[model samples]
Target: MYQVSNGIGFYVLATYFLAAIESKFLRAIPYEIELIPQEEYRSKFCYSVAECRASYPRAMDRGNDFFKYLLSRVVVSSVGGIPKYNVDEDTVIRYMWDVHQAAVDVGKSQLSDVSFYSSETERDFFMDFLLAVEFSVATLYRPYINSTAEFLVGFPHRPLTDQDRNVLASDVTVREKAFMSSVKFFSRTNEATGGLFLTVWKIAMTSEAGRAAGRFLIKRLLLIPSL
Candidate 1:
């Protein structure tokens, strides 16, 4: 039998939390990160976990992008002068890797179908997964912001024009805001429809129209049980 429960709310929360993390982190960066090697910039975040880890072991091993980003900031701050917007090659590389990893993690956790049947194991897995995701998202902010600043200030040479920087910052802000808003709604309820929620978020982040449509549908769906 299909269970219509509030389990869906939990998924919403987790999704928004994830998006919040992204938004906060991106805002922290003073400049936009150009995903070096266009081929590496697949899926916003890197999708191939194995390859991502292998290629950027340092970032993966750190387990917290914020911390790494922070450390980079501390280094720059210590240097005491804002040079051109030239970030070091390694620093940029690592940043790109972290961004990719975030994308991958989100993708993996994203729900494909809303009508999920709960086997005990799957339920437990989802719970654990959400918790892990939450921890990762919450703990890394301060460090990531600090490090991002360091990287941007100490960049080896200024690669981005003022216009480019502005554009990147704007783009990141929009993305982060949209992602977190959806996640906030997702987190407040409990249901086993994570997959469905993920689909909605994906659409919302894609465009203004998609976001309006997604939110409207969600509100309508939420009213069904009451009606």
Candidate 2:
């Protein structure tokens, strides 16, 4: 789920980019607001809606390269953990800005027609280019997960019976059922949810606050017998 503030930031940035494209000029800003340092901006995580709104113009003023780089890092950090990070707002905003800037820059140099959205082919190409850049940046920063061995150990080895297949194909939520089955299968051989929950629990146990939070969450999870 997107944080409300981040979502607002994304909308604001998208509008800004569209405006920049339509006008053929970047929006001018007041001279008083100082530019955020690249490293600091890259590390800054938006924790609230206000922070996201406050930071939007500052990020935009830094230009496309910095924006894109910061965005790529945010995406990487967001997906490196189990619960996943809430960085989508920042990612979407930066991504739109970068794509818009690229289109504008290319239209200036290569096309006789200055408008980027003029040609269907050009629009398609830019869309593909945007996805390609996103993939490339994500791959460059994606963290390595060391769970292959655990996954193999946890996997159900026996061939599925007709009943099992029927249950899998039923109207029930397939992904949730499959995940639950895997956890159950893993628990048959080892404690915890096929080592996944175990790993998280172990990590949580290392600190007092973590342990307290983990216990609270575990209690809540236990109340949900179906889970």
Candidate 3:
């Protein structure tokens, strides 16, 4: 079962990422005041063409690195051998942001370290927090979403039956490569999906309604059920 508690936590994250995306670009919408994030709302999550240009050495390498580092680090510790408590929304949000910043901070200070954050960020590299969607789905009601991600309107963009999260957890491939290792190396859904699926996200991030629809998706598809 999905953690009832992480629903709100994911919502906060979804909201932040959506807002961040909006802040990056502005588009005029029909009958809307103040350039809101999207003008033609078709909000989807599978953005980033990192998987497209596989020839680029660092195209998405950092994003994968960040995701790998974050998966285990973003956890609530169990105390006294009791079952681990559900991570509260504030804690999850704060800890994740803090960790993200910590990784980025070393770059701002120009520190020389081999930590994933510092080393990966050594040059301008990609960091697709969008992969957080994969993480969220990995723990969602439908844990096999990588194979069956139904979009807001299109046919299931990348319906794949990925049932090896447990096995992959202990494998070097997934541990080192995160979502990429999970989808790209096995089954038929290869990294090429990154090329087309990103179109879905662009449509979603184009208008206010589009953005709202996406956030609404976060609430309904992910947040509400778990909550």
Candidate 4:
């Protein structure tokens, strides 16, 4: 039963990923925004695209080098039987800001494209880019999330199945309480859905080329839950 249910659970997640949560957001970007000459936008922004890209290399680093490096040190320096340290929450938080900055830079570059859109297009594009950047950055934390989830898998408390309810019914701990809170949070339907929908609405209403880039991003993010 465990194996079968686990297999079904994995397929459920796979079905979500095939929805292309990230790719859709990338593709949603209107072509006019992409057509903007890199040189012209960079000149106006006073920096090159290379610099912009390099600024957030940590977020782009898929090998998890930074995370692994830190985790190794923590594991090696264990105190007593415990790992002795928690994952650095700062890394994820800082990366979020870095991703947002990248979005701002990309959105700003769109203004130089004179034929990009009608009068109101620019503002809309900026919002879309901002939200899109947010969505992209959010995906970057997937690793940390996976780590946290894995930690929960082998947790002392057993599954929430009815069979184990009696075992945990009379006992509670901070860890257990925290786990319950997290489960309750995720169990809520339409939480992410409504938020993404609002983001999509913002993008659709935008008129500028930059804003269109943003809209493209939001549209993509909105597909994540469906994935």
Candidate 5:
């Protein structure tokens, strides 16, 4: 019958459309992890205090010991005046999941808006979403030095030195400076993103460990400025 043929055609078209949408969604999600080798990691270190100071002059001058403490924990290497830190795979996955959830929340909120359905608007939104995801991931996992003194100084390598103790000391000045620098950096980042970064900061700050870390680095090692 004519009615049966029309129903079959509609169903086929609907199935194809769903498949296309699913493919697009999968491509939009960001889950790739690129690991750096030990040699490559060591190649990125600044090699000396002067190199670190030169790489992040302002942080050295203004960031204090807490900054150094954070630096010591994560510094895998220095790249172009910036200290790059290693992020664990689990941490990177958690960050990506958080970003993805935030995107979903935003998408859901705007679903009823006319602009949400517009092809041009949707395309722009998707592109921006992908970009934000990429920036977040890169910020978290940039390659760095894997020196024995920095990340693996004690356990797998030599014992901690006096210099290491000084660097890791829980000095009050360091903590205060770190807290202040974090506030300033996150404030600026949120302002730049028109409050987008604020949302992410809030979500991250909810965890006790995250809150402690934020109180320390404001968000993470990313708060440390280059030059």
Candidate 6:
């Protein structure tokens, strides 16, 4: 298990951790957010639950990349004129505040005790969750989609196929195998902890292939989703 740090380790862990968080966030608040004043809706909208659900495997990838960009800049500070990477306790909380909770310095910081980057999208984020709740309740109790199977036919964009159904039917076994296969990349017991192993590993991560593989492995493995 690698750790997230103010170093290359951060990149190594970001893809996996962010994917997990994004998946859970959509699951927890699975509703399409609304936008008022058509103008605002057309611009500056971060992510829609429907879109993310439709593209579940690679969901929120663009946002996640931008999140990395914004976060990297935010965490950098000039230490005697040289910029250095840093992520204070408060900053960490703010990044994942909606996704999780921590022993935050309450009162001193606002927006769910994490400061929310000073109401920078964090406000809209909570609003999205609430809106999602209302939408879900309305759809269910009002018998909204009971009329058509189309509502349940698809999750976001992709229509369900027989293969997807089969996967769900044997979810436990399929997931177990998928998880084992994906993480096999990191299960090298023979490799030393230092020297060449560490060097090559870092080099690999510097390339797109290395990072992409990591992202895929984690989405399929640690998360243990049937699909």
Give the C-alpha miss distance for residue 227 in model 5, angstroms: 44
Please provide, for model 3 over 1-227, each residue's C-alpha lDDT reduced to its tens digit, 9 standing for 90 to 100.
01211222333343334333333322243332222222232121112232112322232333333334444353457668744434444334434444334323322232222232222321111222223343223222132355234321211122222333234223333223333332232212223575445455545545556655654554343322221
lDDT tens readout by residue for model 4, 59-167? 2332133333344544445667655445555464444344434434434453434243332322333234334334433433233675436434422243234433334
Per-residue lDDT of candidate 6, residues 180-208 (tens digit): 33333333321334335435544554545
lDDT tens string, model 2, 1-227?
Answer: 11222333343444344334323343364222222333533333333223433544433343444334433442334334533334554444445445444433333233323232434333333333333222222222221254223222322233233445335445434444443443343343333345454455455555557645644443232223332
Question: Compared to the true structure, candidate 6 yields what TM-score?
Answer: 0.21
Judged by whole-model lDDT over C-alpha atoms, candidate 3 comes out at 0.32
Estimate, for each residue in 123-176, the C-alpha lDDT of model 5 and write its tens digit. 333333333333343334222364212211211112222433224334324433
- Which window of 10 residues has the lowest lDDT sum in candidate 6? 1-10
Q: In candidate 3, what residue range of length 10 has the lowest lDDT sum? A: 151-160
Q: What is the C-alpha RMSD of each candidate to the true structure, in Å?
A: 20.0, 19.3, 19.6, 20.2, 24.8, 20.8
Q: Rate the local accuracy (lDDT) of all candidates.
A: 0.37, 0.37, 0.32, 0.37, 0.37, 0.34
Residue-pair clashes, model 2: 1
Instruction: Flag regions of model 5 displaced more than 4 Å.
Output: 1-73, 119-227
Which RMSD does model 6 reach against the true structure? 20.8
* C-alpha RMSD in Å of predicted model 3 compared with the true structure: 19.6
- TM-score of every candidate: 0.21, 0.19, 0.23, 0.24, 0.21, 0.21
Where does candidate 5 clash, by residue pair?
Answer: 44-78, 76-144, 76-145, 77-144, 77-145
Error of 1 at 162 (Å): 49
lDDT of 2: 0.37
